[model samples]
Target: MIRTGNEYREGLKDGREIWMDGEKVTDVTTHPAFKPIVDVRARMYDMQHDPAYKERMTYRDNNKTNPVLYKLPHEQKDWADKLEAVDAVMNDIGGVVTRVGDETIGEMWSLCDGRDVLASIDDRFSDNIDRHIQAVTDNDIFHVSANTDPKGDRSLSPRDRDPDMMVHVTRETDAGIVIRGAKFETAAAYADQAFLKPTVGAWADEELSDYAVGCIVKMGAPGVKHICRSGFAGKSRAADYPLSNKFDEVEALVVFDDVLIPWEDVFFYRHTKAAQYVRSSLHRYSAFPYVLRLLYVADMMIGTALWNARQTGLDKLQAVREKIADLVCYREGINAHLTASIAAAQRSPGGLLMPHQSMLYAGRVFAVSQLQNMMHIARELCGGQICITPNADSFEADGSGEWLNKFYSLNQRWQADDRRKLLAFARDLLNSDYAGHRLTFVQFAQAPHFSHLAAVYQSFDFEGPLDFVRKSAGLSDQVKG
Candidate 1:
C-alpha cells in the first residue's frame, strides 16, 4: 500500500478549502506556498517505493510493505530503524521537515499507550486509537495532530464568553459529533487527517465539558476550512531565500465550522479523565522525532559556519576556531542526547519502545532553548558579509558583476560566483526572514518552552536524587513524605 509522489499530490485535490494571501486556493499541490513542502512530503512517500531506498524506508508486515516510520515500536531496533530511515530521508531531501507524518504519528502512539485510561472513559475510544494508528500505516495517510486552540478572551471562562473560542462539541448527531472553533496547526491544509484533541489545560477541573473531546478530523470534511499564514515562499526570490522556497511548511488556522466527526473516528468525548490522561502523556513517543529534527538543524548550523570559515580563511585564527568549536559543541550536544536516548530506550505502557523520557525531554529542552543562541553564533562566524552582501541579481548584472567578481574572487580557487552562493545560502539559513521564522518554529514546535521544562520535571526521577541526599546528610523518613 505504499503511495507514489503523484498519488500523494492527487490526495490534496479533494476539494479541501484552503485560503492563502487573501485568496482561495484551488489546488494545494500546485500552489507556490504549499507545493514545495507538499512536494517534499510527496518525495518522502515516493522514496518508500524507490528500490534503492525501499529496504531502508519500508518493512514487510502481514505480506504487505509498510512505511518504516509508521510502524509501531516493539524494541530498541525499532527505534534504531526509525533513526536510520529518518536519516535516509534527511539526506535525500536535504533539509528538515517537522510535520511530515512521522513526527506527528507518534502523538497517536502516545494515546495508544494511554488506552487503559481511554477505555475507562469509553471502550470504543481505545479501539478507535488502535485502528487509526494502523490505518496510517496501511493506507499511508499523511497524519498530523491538532492540540492547541485559539483561546480568545482567556480572562473569561469558556462558558462566560464565546464557547467557540475553544473547539467544543456544539451538538451530537447519530452520525457524529458536531464541532465548532479553530486550532493553530502546521501542515493541516495538505495533510490527510488530523488526530484532534483538547488543548493542554486543567482537564481535571471539568468532568463532562463539551471541550473534552478527541477525534479524527478529515482535512477535506465539509465544514473544515484552512486559513493559512502567509508562507515564507513566493514572496522572496528563490536564490535569495532557497530554504524558504523549498522547505517552508505552511501552518494554518484550521476553522471547524460545525465539522462532523463520525462515530468510529471519535476517540473520547465529554470525558475529563481521558483528557487529563492524554494531556499528560501526549508527547511521550512523539518528542523523540520532534527533538531529532533539531539535531539536523544543529548540523545545518555547524555545516554553514564551518564552510563559511574555510571559505574566508578564518579557520586559522584562534578566536574563529573557538567559535566553530562552540558550534560543534552544540551540534554534538544534540547528537549525544539523541544517541543516548536511543541507547537507553524504554517500553511504553502499550508495549512500544520509547526513548528514555529523561534524556529525550531534557534533550528537547536543551536543543530548543539554545537554538537561537546557536544561530547567533553561526551568524557571527559567517561574518557580517551575510547581511551586507548584494543580491544574486547584482552579482550577475553588467557593471556590478565585474566589480563584485574582482572583490569576491579571494583566490584562484575561491571565485565570485561561489562566494555569492555561499553568502546567499548562509543568509537564508541564519539571517533571512525565513531563518527567523524557522527559529521561532523550532521554539514552539511540539509545545512551548514551559511545557518542555514541565516534561523534564515530570519525567526525571526526583526520588533518586532525594535518596542520595538523604543518605549523605542522614536526613530521614520524616521528610520523605
Candidate 2:
C-alpha cells in the first residue's frame, strides 16, 4: 500500500536509538541534520499520491495501489517502469538522493535468485528468502543494505582479536538467534530496516563460520544503536551549499548489541557456500540503479560547464568546444552502457529479468573510475571564479554590496546576485567539503574499484573469444575438445 509523507516520518519516531555529533537525536524527522533529507524522502512518498505522479509512481494489484519501486522485476517492462518511477522522484526532488528505498531493495532480489544455493543448506532458509521478498513489497517497507562490518584487523581472525569485529551468531534461541557487531550503513538512522550480511571475504573453504550470516535487521529493534557521522546540513547556509544541505544521506555505525533475529528473518546462517554466493552476486540487479544515478551526475557536470562557457562566451572557442565534447562523451558513455544492458537483459535463474551482467558491471567501473577526471574537467571549464567568488552574504552586505555588484555584474542578463548563486552552487558541487565526500561515496559506496573490475571479469564470457582464436589459428578438433 502507498503511504503518505507524514506516515513515513511518523514511522521513524519509534524510539529508535540514534546518536549524532555526540548527542542523541530525539526525532530524526525533526532533527536539524536529518530533517532536510527526511523531508526529501517524505516528499517522494507524498508524490505517489499526487494525481500528476500517481500513475508513474505506483501500480495497482488486486485493486490495491502499491509503490512501483518495491515491485520485483519479472519482465522488461517491469524494469522500464521502475526507471520511470526513479526519474520522476529525481526530477521532483531536483537533485539525487540515494538510499531512499528503490536503490537498495534489489539486494533482497539478488538473494532470492540464490534460492537454490540457500536451499542446499536448508530448505526452510530458501522459504525465508521468498517470504521476506514478498513481505517488503506487500508491506511497502523502506529497506537498505548492510554489508560492510568494521573489521578490527585484516590479518587476525575475529576469534583472535575481537569477536565483535564481524557480526556473528552469538547464540541460537528457540525463537531466533542473537547477534553482536557493527555495520557501516548509509541512511540506517532513518531507514526502517537493513538486509545485514557478510562483507567481502574468503569463506568457500570453510564448512562453517560464525561470520557467515545473513538476516533482515529491524532498525528500531532493541540494542540497535545508530551512531551517525556529523551531518553536512545545518553546518552552513543553504544558499552556499544547496546540495549538501538538502541531499546528504547520513551514514551511521550501526551497533547491534545482542540483537535478536527471529527464525522468519534469518535467510542463512553458518553456511559458507551461501555466504560466498551472496558476496559474489550481491550487485547483480542493484548495479543498474547504482550506475544509473551517475548519468544524472554527468548531466549536472555538463550543464554546469556548458552554462559557465555560455556566460563568458567561451563556447565560441574551438578548444572550449572540444572540452565540452569530452564531457558529453563521458555522459553518453554511461548512457550507452545502461541502455545496452537493458536491451540485452538476461533472465535470472529465479525467473527475474536482470540487466546483462557484463555490461552493467563494466558500466559501473567506467562511470566510477572516471568520475574524478570528469569532475576536474568541469571544474576547469567553470574557471577559478567559482572558488574566488565571495559568499551571498557579502554581496548583500551594506558596505561591500555596491562594490561587489559593480564587479560581479557581467551584462544585461548576468546580474551580481545570479552570478554569486551560480558560483556558490559550482563550489558546493566541485570544491566544498561536501563535494569531496560525495566523490568518495561514489568510489566506495557500492564496493571498491577492484571489486567492480572483478565483477566484469567474472560475468564476461571467455569461451567465445577462445573458440574464435582457436579456429583462426587452424587448431585441430582435438585441441578444441
Candidate 3:
C-alpha cells in the first residue's frame, strides 16, 4: 500500500506538538522551515507509486499478496533486488533526506522484527511487524535513530547521571507509560513519529526496567518538543551555500514531557534486558545499510574531488592524482566490503541478520580509516578556493560581477560563475555542520562502537586460514596424525 507524495505531505499535516526556538511549531507540513523537508520525504513516498519504481521499491510478501521493500538482505536474488531497490532510492543524494522519518525508522524496525528483538515479547511485536512494515513502506518515512543518552558527565552511569539527562519511564499504567527526559543529536526529530528503542544502554535488572520502555508516538504528541540547532531555517537561494540550501540534514534535540504511549505501540516495557535485544535488531539491520550508504557517499566525494582538481588544472599533476587515487581506494574498499556483506548474508531462524563477521568488520575498519583520506583529498584539491569563493549573491550583483567573473573562471569549458557555484557546493560538502553528519554516521553507526567491530572480527572462524597455513608449511599431519 504505497502512498503518493501528495498523500505523504498531507499526512504530515496532522497536528503534532513540536517546539523550536522556544515557540510551538503549529504546522510542520506547511511551516517555512519544514515544508521543503516534508516535500523531500514526500518524494520518497511517491517513489512506490511511480510505475518505473514500483516494482523495485515494493515487493511481494510471503503471503505473496502484499508487497514489502526494506533494508534487510534476502537469500534469494529477488530479495537481494529488494535491498538494492531501497538502497538505490535512499543512497542517492547521500541518504541525507532532510528530515529523518519513516525510511530511517522503518529500517531499524525491520532490523528489530527481522532479529526477533520485538518478537520475543510474547510475539506481540511479531504480530504487528507486517502492519508496521507496510505503514512505513507506504509512507516512505525517514527514521532518526536516537540511541545516545546524555551522560551528563562522562564518569557516570545513566542512573548516576541526572535522571533527566536519560530518557526513562517516569510513570506507567495499564494503558501505557509516560517517558520524561531528552534524546540529544536526534537527526530527524521533526520528521519522525514516536522515538524507537530501549533508550540507549539499560541493564536487565528490575531497577532499570523503567528505562526499558520503548514505543512509537506521533510527532508533536502532547508533551513532545523539538529544539533545532542554530542555522537558517528556510531554504536559502543558490547564491547561498548549495549544501545549506538544497540538502540540509536537520538534527535537533527532543524533549518528551511525560508523553503517553499506548500499549499496542510499545515493544518493550520494564524489561531492561529487552533493550539489548531491541538494539541488536536496529544496529544489525538498519545501521549496517548506513555503512553501505556512507560508502556511496565516499564515491561521490571522490568524483567531486577529482573533478575539482581537474577544473583547477591540477589533474595533470602527480601530487593531485595521488590524492584522487587515495580517495578511490577508500571508496572501493568500502564498496567491496559492503558487497561481501550483502552476498554472504543469510536469514537466521531468529530473522534476517548480517552476521558475516568478516564482512561487518571489514566495513567498519574501512569506514573510519578512509574518512580522513577523503576529507584530505577535498582539502588538497580545492585548497583555499572552497573557503574564498564569492557567494552566489555576489555574482548576481552588478557592482562586482565583472571582477568576480574574471577572477573565478576555470577553463572555457565552464563559466566563472558556474565554477564558483561548484566550489561553494564542494566547500559545504567538505566542511559544514551537515558535513559533520557524515562523520557521525561513521563514528556511531554501530552501537557499542568499536566493540561490535572487535566482536565480529574475533568471532570469525580464522581456523580455515590456519589449516591452510599448516598444509603449506607441510606440518598438517603433525596434529591430525
Candidate 4:
C-alpha cells in the first residue's frame, strides 16, 4: 500500500480553491508558483520509497488495516522510528525551509484527537486519534497545522478583532459547527490536506464557546481559501543553487469562509480553563520534533558557514574560529536537550508514550533563545563575503562573468563560482526578507516559553529538595509555635 511519489503528486491534483494575488489557482499541483513546492513534496514521498530510506521513513502497523507502512510496528517504537525517519529526511534537506516535509506534515495531522498531548483531557478523542493514525497508515496523506490565527492586534482578543480577522466558530448545529475568519502565516498549505488547528485557547469572553472548536476539512472545502505569501527562494534565479532549491517558500494565509466542521472532528470545545493545557500539550509533543529539526539546521548552517569561511580564507582568523565555536555550542546544546527529552519520556496508562513536558519546554526555550545567536555568529564570522557574493546568474552572465569569477576566488583549490554558491546560500539564510520572517517565527514560538517551565516546577513536589536543605542546615521539621 506504500504510495509511489507520482501517486502522491497525482493525489494533490484533486480540485482545491486557492487564491494568490487576486487570482484563483485553477490547479494547485500544476500552478507555476506551486509546482516546485509540489515537486519538493513528491521528492519526500520518493524518499519513503527510496531503497536506502524506505525502511526508516515508511512503516507498517498492525493497527493499520491496510499495510501502507513501509516498516511496521504495533507499539510506540513505530512512532519514534517514524520520527527518526522524519528527522533524517529533514536534516538531509536543510531544516529551515523544508519545515513541512511530507512526512512531517503527515505526522502532524496524524493525531487530530489529541492522543499525543490531549490524552489527559478527554478519552473520547482517542478513537478520533486511532482513526487518523489508521487512515494515515492506509492513505499516507500529508497534513500541516495552522496554530497561529491573525490576531490583528496582540493587545486585543479574538472577539475584539474584526470577526473575520481571527479564525472562530460562528454557529453551532447538531450536525457540525461553522467557522469564520482566517489563519495567517500557514506553511505549505497548497500541498496539505487541511490545517490542524488555529487553537481554541486564549479565548475572549465572547469567543469562549468558539475556543473548543478544532477540526479538519479538506483543503478548499466549502469555505477554505489559500492566500499566498511572497517567497525569497523560488523567485530568485539563484534558486537552482544547492540550498535554495530545497527551501520552502510555500506559505499562505488560510481564510475560512464559513467552513463546517463536524462534531466528530471537534476535539476540545469550550473548556476555557483547559485552553492553556491543550496548547501546552501540543507544544509538549512538538518540542522534540522541532529540536530534532533545529539540530539538523544548525549542522547545515555550521557546515555551510565553515565552508564559506574556508573558501574565503577567513577561517584562519582566531575570531572567526571563536564564532564557529559558538555556533557549534548552539548545535550541541539543542542536541543535548533533545537527548534529555527522549530519556525523560513518560508513559500514559493507555500505553501511549508522552514526552516530559518540563524537559520538552526547556529544550524549545533553549532553541528559540539561541537560534538568533547562531545566525548572528554565522553572519558576523562570514563578514561581507555573504552579502557581496554575486548571484549564480551573474556567474553565467556574459557581462560580468570573468570579473566576478576572478575577483571572488581566493586559493586555487576553491573555484570562484563554488564560493559564490556557498556565500549566496549563507546570504539567503542571513540577510533575506524570508530569513527575517523565520527569525520572527522562532522568537514568537520561544517567547513566554519559560512559563511552561515554571508551571512544571510548580506542579511537581520539590519537598524532597527542600527537606534536604533543611536537614543540611539542621533546621527542625516541626511546626512553628
Off by over 4 Å in 2: none
- Candidate number with greatest lDDT: 2
Candidate 3 lDDT by residue in tens digits, 354-431:
546467666766776567667867777778777777677777789888889888876688678668867876776777
Model 1 poorest ten-residue lDDT run = 198-207
The estimated TM-scores of all candidates read 0.98, 0.98, 0.85, 0.84
Q: Name the regions of candidate 3 deviating beyond 4 angstroms.
A: 60-68, 71-73, 76-79, 86-131, 134-144, 185-188, 199-208, 231-236, 351-357, 445-459, 462-481
TM-score between model 1 and native: 0.98
Q: For residues 20-136, what per-residue lDDT tens digits would candidate 4 score against the true structure?
A: 768887877676666666766667777776778867776545543232222233345645675677666665554454344332333333244245445555665545556555555
The reply for model 4, stretches above 4 Å from the true place, is 63-80, 91-98, 101-126, 153-161, 195-208, 239-245, 314-316, 445-465, 473-481
- As for candidate 2, its clashing pairs are none
lDDT of 2 by residue, 12-74 (tens): 988999999899999999999999999999998899999999999999888888899988888
Compared with the true structure, model 2 gives a TM-score of 0.98
In candidate 2, how many Å is residue 280 off? 1.0
Q: Lowest lDDT 10-mer window, candidate 3?
A: 94-103
Error of 2 at 160 (Å): 1.7
C-alpha root-mean-square deviation, each candidate = 1.1, 1.1, 3.9, 4.1
Give one digit per residue, the lDDT tens place, for model 1 in 303-322: 88888888888889999889
- Between which residue pairs do clashes occur in model 4? 59-69, 59-70, 59-71, 60-69, 60-71, 60-72, 212-268, 212-269
